[model samples]
Target: MRDAIKQLAESRSECTTRQTWYSALFSYNYPNSSETLRTVLDLLITARNEKTTQLQDTGLDPAVRARLQDEVSPLIHAHLPDPIVSEKGAIGIKAESVYQFYECDAGRAAVVFVSEILTAVTTELTHTGSIGYPLTTVLASAVGVHSRFLQASKKQVLDDLPI
Candidate 1:
């Protein structure tokens, strides 16, 4: 399941590029296909349901679970493209706040902040210095990767924008 989630994340990253390319094709082709749009919406709904179910089964602490869910839910809501197909073949995937969360310095900062908090909590819970140091290092590395991801996304958005 973890692998599946990781793959999904990776696929989503690649799909962003495909989306840009397809937007141009879509604008020229079938610009109004409610049926096709509906299929995408249905798939999103199914994915969300599965994720929710997985979260429920994880048995994480209620507070932690709530916080994670709260943080992720808005991103899901914001990023889920409206089924409306534009003339430019844009699927109306407008979620500037959510996009910014994955594309800006502030967003990277938030990830680092959360990672540090988690590291501290883990350190306190286990009282095992060995584990804490490695976890901290991993979290720090994640912050760097996330920052790079955001930078690339920002560049892509800028490239796609109309002058």
Candidate 2:
């Protein structure tokens, strides 16, 4: 978890998406609001604990790990005007939806991605003096990665829950 967090933050420093504008999932605000950051940290910690315990209890096989890396980690998207779910945005993903999704394999993978983002943000802040990195810079990273993970399972996770 520590290594993943550090590596994620380092990778974002080179994010090309900064050339264009973007925001975190369910948020229009740049960087992240304190409340939102808090929420992200909470989610990250929970995911860390969960995944850690999971691996400890049931070590992953090489094939299973490879499958997760291939199917669950990559960002796949439909090219066009964009998916209907994305055409219309929301203030944030419903917590209930995330909770339900947490029980599934895809959901767990998504959680790992989101956790990476929060971990990166936290790491950057640690070196930003007192004020920390600009919110814009924080959110400016390539939008499609972590957000994709969160969005990938949105319909299945959220189900009939309102956006």
Candidate 3:
């Protein structure tokens, strides 16, 4: 169980292996399944909230953060448009969605955005041995990506959830 949880955090681990681990958690038919699953879920939720707060408190101005997030929406929308119902009735994205996300225009933009950021970081590191790349340059690249999305038809945002 410990190893399985560790696998979830390893980027290079095979998706099938991760899926198997998730399945095991759900398939455990022991009397303690309910308590165990609840504990695991609470831990996951707490960790997520902490990370989100960290990101939200980053020194970037709120406007800059919002602009960057808007640029990233396309990739997120493509990747998570579908829901997967798991063995224990948990809803989530399939690991395979990672591959599918890179196939569309938004995904392509994400690739370019990532490449721009990586290039900026690498160049900065090679020249100064520091990660103090300028925020303006990153935001500029994001704006360029956002312009491309603007030319595409906008997706309607639903104001209300279906009952």
RMSD for each of the candidates:
16.4, 15.5, 18.0
C-alpha local distance difference test of each model: 0.38, 0.35, 0.35
Select the stronger candidate by TM-score from 1 and 3: 1
On TM-score, the candidate that comes out on top is: 1
Best by lDDT: 1
Each prediction's number of clashing residue pairs: 0, 1, 0
lDDT of 3 by residue, 62-151 (tens): 886676554333222222222222223222222342211111233233333343344444444546544445764564566566646633
lDDT of 3: 0.35
Candidate 1 residues 1-163, lDDT tens each?
Answer: 2223233433444454422211111222332332343344445556655657767766678887786565346325423321122232223233332211112232333343343344344444445354567766676566556546544423222221110
Using all chains and alpha carbons, the TM-scores for the candidates as numbered come to 0.27, 0.25, 0.26
Considering summed lDDT, which 10 consecutive residues are worst modelled in model 3?
154-163
Model 3 CA deviation exceeding 4 Å by range:
9-31, 60-163
**On TM-score, who's better, 2 or 3?**
3
